[model samples]
Target: MSDYSIRLYVDSDYEVTRNLFRNGIIEHHNKAFHHALQRPHIWLPALVVLTLPALNLVSVTTSILVVLTAVAAIWFYCRYMYTSYVDYALSDDMLDISKYYLQRDGFCFWVAETRGGEVVGTIAALPSSDPGGEKHLELKRLSVATKHRGKGIAKVLCRTLIDFARRRGCEAVVLSTSLAQINATKMYEKLGFRQTHSFYPPGLLGQFLDFKIIAYRYDIPAL
Candidate 1:
């Protein structure tokens, strides 16, 4: 038997849930910075900067400082972008889970709690906003506490959402995850979700960084 129980969101879960969302999203900044640095466009410039000292154009210390400054700038930019996303999400449906999800038909948020009654994870399902996919559900806000992961809490939470969708007669369950969420993508695939498409997130920063969001769908088989 599982040690965790999944239940609908309650007013008391606000603070912890928000923190989970913020930290879970922000935690990817480091990975994103690393991924950004791996891009030729980004690293090539740093490489060129590093060669300056060898070319006798700049002192070794000066070259190192310039490269470090560029890396710091990229790190800060990634942090800012993620922070901005979290703020926007908090101001959106996440601002009031009860009002946005609990009260709406076919939209619900759930929290996973341990036997000791500690909230360890969160997941939400909402009607797909895409045209012609009204029967589909979009899973969102799925996050597990760092220390609590690898205990199958995330899988349980996903299964709970999937079961809920199936009972609601939904045609499919879909979710969008970013490249920085490599583990999440792998988990989704393990749960039988197939990649439908991918696109860069909206905004200039996303385009410049070449950050992409992959969409996955799990189609329910006919009963």
Candidate 2:
């Protein structure tokens, strides 16, 4: 917040912004891994493995092998999911920022630059899925570097997008965040965003997992 100013994204800022987003997701992933490991669901698999040996349904050696396999599978699954998300983002809007963001109507990307010319944060606003109804705007890729946290950079970035959307006659601003981002959720709430939808991937795997993505919407007042 000292000498930093938020400005529209440019071609030269693409690499820096992309890397910042990648690192931000990785930071959340690591925190989520630790939080998930502490949950009862992770322990349930081990509990079943231990109980099988005690109940004589499986031999001790077999029980140990099963536990090892389950642990390995869980580890692999988490890493795979994280990698998939990163790859998709890289190939999507982040791949060609100008095409997906800059060139689109009612879409814009912004990056926060320091007095020394370092990009420290980014945020964007894009047309909502239902553009004809309610005139919505979706805020995307809001992130600030770790070293720049607690300095009001994120708040500035968020406000910048919201104000921009308001000026364009948007009725509301919408965004989504995963459960892993506890702090971000709180910040959104503090910014007057209300929880609108809770989402999770489909299928049996999703039912068994604790993963959830929560959507929030901020109703904009007429300017």
Q: Estimate each model's TM-score.
A: 0.95, 0.89
**Candidate 1 residue runs with Cα over 4 Å from true position:** none
**Candidate 2 C-alpha lDDT tens digits along 117-199:** 99999998898885464589998999899998888899889999999898989899999887888889989998899999897
Please list the C-alpha lDDT of all candidates, in the order they appear: 0.91, 0.84
| lDDT tens per residue, model 1, 64-100 | 9999998898899888878998999999989998999
Clashing pairs in 2: none
Residue 81's C-alpha lDDT in candidate 2? 55
Q: Pick the candidate with the highest TM-score.
A: 1
